[model samples]
Structure formats: C-alpha cells, structure tokens
Target: MRSHHLLPLLLLCILFLAQCTKEEDTSPAENLMQEASKISYTYPALSTEPMQKASTLTAAEWNDLANWQLWTPQLKLGAGRLVQEKWHFALQHRYTVVLTDSLHKRITDARITLETSQGTLLDESRTDNNGVSYLFLTAPTKPEDLRLKIVYADQVFYIGDLNPQNGRIEKQLNIQRNVSPVMDILFVANTSLATADKLVYLQKELKEIINKTKSQSDSTLHIRLGSIFYGLHAGNSVIRTHPFILQPEPTLLTFTKPYTTVTHSPETIDLALEEAIYRQAWAKNASSRLLFLLLDTPFLQDPGTITRLSSLSREAARQGIRIIPVSMGSMNLSGELLLRSLAIRTNGTYIFVTHPEEGLSNPLSTISTYTDEPLNNLMLRLLVKYSKLN
Candidate 1:
C-alpha cells in the first residue's frame, strides 16, 4: 500500500511538471505571433507608382519644386512661409518684430507683447535665438492700431503705432548685450531591408553635410546635431535615438553601419517621427530646429495612424520645427501623399531623391544654403522709419 502508491504519485507529478515547462517555453513565441497578427497592415488604395520623370529633374530644380504648395494647389501656403499671398486681397496682416542691441547683435529670449489701443492683449511671444518674434493679426485689426512692448533684462520698452503693413519692424535697443544664435538638427534614417544598399551612400553624404555645416558655423551661431535609426525586426520595433551633441560622428557611424539583419515589412515611420518630435532634446529658445528624414518605405496605416500623424505634425509645427523628408527611392502614392502632408503641416519641405544609390550630396547642399538664410527682413522704408523711433 506504500511503495507502489508512492511510485505512481511521483510519476504523475513528473509528467505534470514537464507539461508546465513545455508550455512556458513555447508561450513567448506564441505571444510574439499573436502580436504580429494584431498589427494591421492597411496600405492606402492609391497606386504604388513612383513619380513620373522625376529622375530628369536636376537638384536645383528639385530644390525649387520641393515646396508643398506647388504640389498641392488646393491648399494654402504652409505656415513656415513668412510671406503669403492674400486671398482676394483680404486684410490678413502678419508682422515680424526683430530686436537687436546697439551693436546690431540679435537679442534672445526677450518677452514681446502686442496690445490694442484699448489695453487689450493681442499676442505675446518671447524672441527666439535670432531675436525675432512673430505676431499674426487678421482683418478688422489694423497694424496701426496695435502697440508693441518688449521686456528684456528686467527693463521694459514700448513702441506705439506699428505700421507693419509695409514690412517687418526692427528695433535697435541702446543695450550692448548679445546672445549667440542656437540651432538643432536631427537626422532620422530608415535602415530596413529595402534600403540596405543605400545606407552607405546616405552615411557618406550625411557626414559631408555635417562637416560642411560645422565649418560654416562660427561663434555667432551654435549648432547641435543628433540622429535616429529605425527598423522593424521579428515583429518588434527597433529605434535608436542619440541626444544632441557637439560631435555626432560616432553615433552616425554606428547607426548607418552595413545592414545584415533581416527586417520585416511595413515601416514604422510614424513612430520614428513621433520620437523625433517628442523625445529629442530640442532647445527652448533655438533659432532653428530641423529634422531630416530619409526613408523609402511607406507607413503602415494602422488604427492609430491618423491620430498619431495629426498630433505629431501639430506638435512639430507648434514648436517651430521643420521636417525635411527625403524619399530615397520609388515611393507609392500613399507614401508620397503622407510625407507631403507632413511637410506642409509643419512648414517643412518634402524632397524626393529619385536615385538613392547616387547619394544626397546635392540636395544636402541646397538644404544647407536654405537654412543659412534668415526667415524675415524689413523693407528699406520700414527700416528707415524704425531708425527714427525712440
């Protein structure tokens, strides 16, 4: 009654334990498959055909044509464009206020307030690293009826009877303080299986551009660089983000290395862009914030695609961050439309590199020149008038 019963009970217990171990060992793989199945890969119904005759266009032509307004005539000009044509000659007034020290050095972080003649606040913003603030007004409120006030270094100065309709207004304070302009740039690359061969070319072009931009920067302007590499492998998302740094060569090398890992399809571009917009260490008072996205894959139109894209683009626009998307190879209509919309929403540029294997040196050069210029300038008459202000 003792030995025989104990032997059977031990055998049963061993079989149960082995079964439990087997389930535990296989659960992880099962869970992964389940997750992969849950992912909805809804490609847009539009054709995947690439743009026609894109390869014939020169780099300079591409630079001029990359604007979103040219691509979509129905939509208004992007917010990034300072000068926009008024529809039907409507009274839409946009004013730029530039503050400078006596020595003509741009002032940073100065509090600017626009008020009405009746002591009502119209808008308020702090001057960016470029010592510029933007005030937008619509019809029924003329610039002549608005007054501008600036507060800097605990001192307040006031300018009344603004006439920005003619051009931007510049005010030179008697103070001698100067602040260096700050700019931040981040490069986001898609290192998936589809773009494996083009990574080397991209890496070389990026390094060259980085060096060029660095050489152009002097003590007057400070530049910080960062990068993000994104891919999907084995039903999991892989994203590598580097913080802003003075030197990003090592990070770029590691990110753009030869791709031997096999990646899954349906790029997580939305997630990569979300990380770029929200997770990056952008300066609060940066004069310019830019993101250069290189990708050939289209976004997976999942359930959260619209909401995520809308929120990300709005946030980028609010922060005055411009996104430059460079489509590396032949892109589908869906991908083109999405990227184009993002650029327009954020006042950014959408660039299509018809030949990715050739590298991006030409386009990068164009971008460098474009970013080096100032966003706004006052007309000669306005400058003359402003010079006489107290």
Candidate 2:
C-alpha cells in the first residue's frame, strides 16, 4: 500500500515538473501572440479627408518612386481561379481585391457580386469604357466570408486577393517638390548615435553643393545646421543644445534631444521641432528639405522599449527619421519584437542587422536604401510630379 501511494505521488511530481519546464521554454513570441490576440485594432476617428489630404503622392508619383525604388507595393496574384481560402482581419479591418485580364483583349463589361461566408453582401459592376475598369473600397469587413464572381467576362481572369492591410493598390501620383541636393547636415556624432558615418558623409557631400548653388526650385538647399556633439552626457550639455541658438544662421531642421534622463519621458521640445522639418520634405509647394535622426536603441526612455513607442509614432508622422531601431544583438524574435514596437510607436520601419559593421553608415542611407530604394519610390515620384501639377 505504501509503495503504491509513493508511485502515484512521484508521477504527479514528474507531471508538474514537465508542465513547468514547457512553460519556461516558451518564448516571448508565444507571449506576444497571446497579448496580440487579447487586443483588437480600433480605427481612429480621423476623417477620410485627412487621410486623403495627408498623402500628396499620386499614382504617377508612386510609380516614379517605384522606378527609383523608394517604395514598392506588395503584390499577390492568385495561383489560378481562387476557389476559396480563409483570411483573418488586420487592424480589425477586412477587405478583398479582385483582378481580371481579358485573355489578351480589353475587358469591356463585367459585373461582380460579393458574398460572405454567411450570405450575399454586395452586387456591383463597371463597363470598360476603354480597356479596363476598377473600383476603390473604403469600408472594412470581416474575413474569408467574402467572395466575388464574374458575370460579364466569365473566363476573363483568376480572382486575386486585395487585402488593404497587406497591400496598397491606390493610384499614386508624384508630387513635384525639389529636394535640395545640397545642405548643411549637422553631424551629431554621439557614440550613442548609430548612423554617425552617414551623417558625416551627407555633411561632406551636401554642404559643398549647398555652398555652390541654390536648388533648382530656387529654395535655399540646406539639410541640417548647428553642431555634432560626441561624448558621454554630450546630449545634456547646453553648449550645443537648443534654445541656446534658435536663430536663422543655423536653421533648426531636426535635433536629437537628449536621451531620456528618466524613464518614459517624451522626446525633448527641440527634437519635436526638428521632426516638423522632416515631415515637410515632400510637402506640396514647399521646399524639399529634411532632418533625420539615428538613435542607438534600448535607451533609458522605456523598458523593453515598448512603453515609449506611442510618442515616437506621433513624432514619426511629423518628423522624417522614419524611426529605425538597430539592435546590437541578433535579429531574433525578441529583436524583431523590439523593432515592431518601434514601428508601432513611431510609424517608422525597422531593419535588423546584428553586427555594428553591417549597420547603415548614415541617415541618408536609411532613406536612400530603406525608404527610397523600396517600392514607395512610386509614391515619392508621384509627390514630386504632383508638386509640378500645383
């Protein structure tokens, strides 16, 4: 009897240990998914007008930028006739995209009916005037429950998925704003800053150009101004800090406010001012100039860097740095989480290159390589062209 009781107890202990070990082995990614599941994206109240007004780049601009590789849209063409598939909502918004080619002929007429998993939701159509017809959907919906059928051009083309969260298909035109080819780029060379070399490169190349001639748009072409402070506590020093010199000689485009002295503090006022300049770089009818930042990550601002990202996101909208977080560590799930956190917080993109040697050399490289080299080039071009339109 004693032996039998002991065996049961031993088994129970073993099971308990096994469960504990499994939980221990589970990674942060698992934990994050759990957290993400608990939360749902609620659309902000900002009107569609602002959203439309905010983007000045037209289809042509986007396409031109695409040519330059500034930004690219993510495209997904189905394997064949997309019979059926399941999809989840992103940002609590669900959408469908349909595309059809008339074999080789121009598709003149087509009607589409949308059905949800539950039942029919919408019936719509457009007759091709020239060669094609397209539609824009602004409302959000629930998942795979949606379907489309071709009534006119029955065997025209396969059904393609158009999930807005995954891709943007809007026709983008370029805004024609002349980005100054030359400027006085401030090289704030803090050991804490990551892209010091790139700043130095811009300073060297652009400064010369700004000195030689004005921008084609006839606006003064200066990218940055003031000093490049390098050293510990250099961020705190008043000598090169803002307010000390806010006048016109060295125009204040962007400034890296001192890193948070306390946990979770917002970026300094000076930094905020600089971001304003960055956002207007492609503003319609405005001189194209920018001020960017290259901050080293895991700073004192917030723990896990997650808590502090909200303020960063707003700043990103106004400022041009496109908040990129470079981890000194490997690009693992945790590192990616950090990057994602920054992206969420600042409306910026993330790049995970582990070694310092492999990091971007300067601020321009981030735009030139990451932002401009991508498909958004189309957006940029559209904006540039749009400026001319104005």
Q: Highest TM-score, which number?
A: 1
Which regions of candidate 1 fall more than 4 Å away from where they truly are? 1-72, 76-177, 219-222, 249-253, 257-264, 285-287, 301-303, 356-390
The predictions' CA RMSDs to the true structure, in order, are: 21.3, 18.3
The TM-score obtained by model 2 is 0.34
Worst 10 residues of 1 by lDDT: 371-380
Residue 366 of model 1, lDDT score:
16
Runs in model 2 with CA error above 4 Å? Answer: 1-21, 29-291, 301-306, 318-321, 324-336, 339-348, 351-390
Residues 1-390, candidate 2: write the lDDT tens digits.
000011334335544554566554433333332222322212112211122222221111011112212111111112100101111101112122323342323232233434454544443333221122222222445435444444442343223343344432221112211232332222222333343433333333333333333322225333334443322442452224332121234234243443334322222223432433232233221122222233343333233233334334434432222233433222233323334333322222343331223332221111221221211222222222222211
Relative to the unseen true structure, what is the C-alpha lDDT of residue 302 in candidate 1, on a scale of 0 to 100?
56
Per-residue accuracy of model 1 over 145-220 as CA lDDT, tens digit each: 8898887777888888887634478999988754435667787888776666555544434454444444434434
lDDT of 1 at 83: 20
- Assess candidate 2 and give its lDDT: 0.29
How badly does each model clash, as a count of residue pairs? 0, 59
Task: Give candidate 1's TM-score.
Answer: 0.54
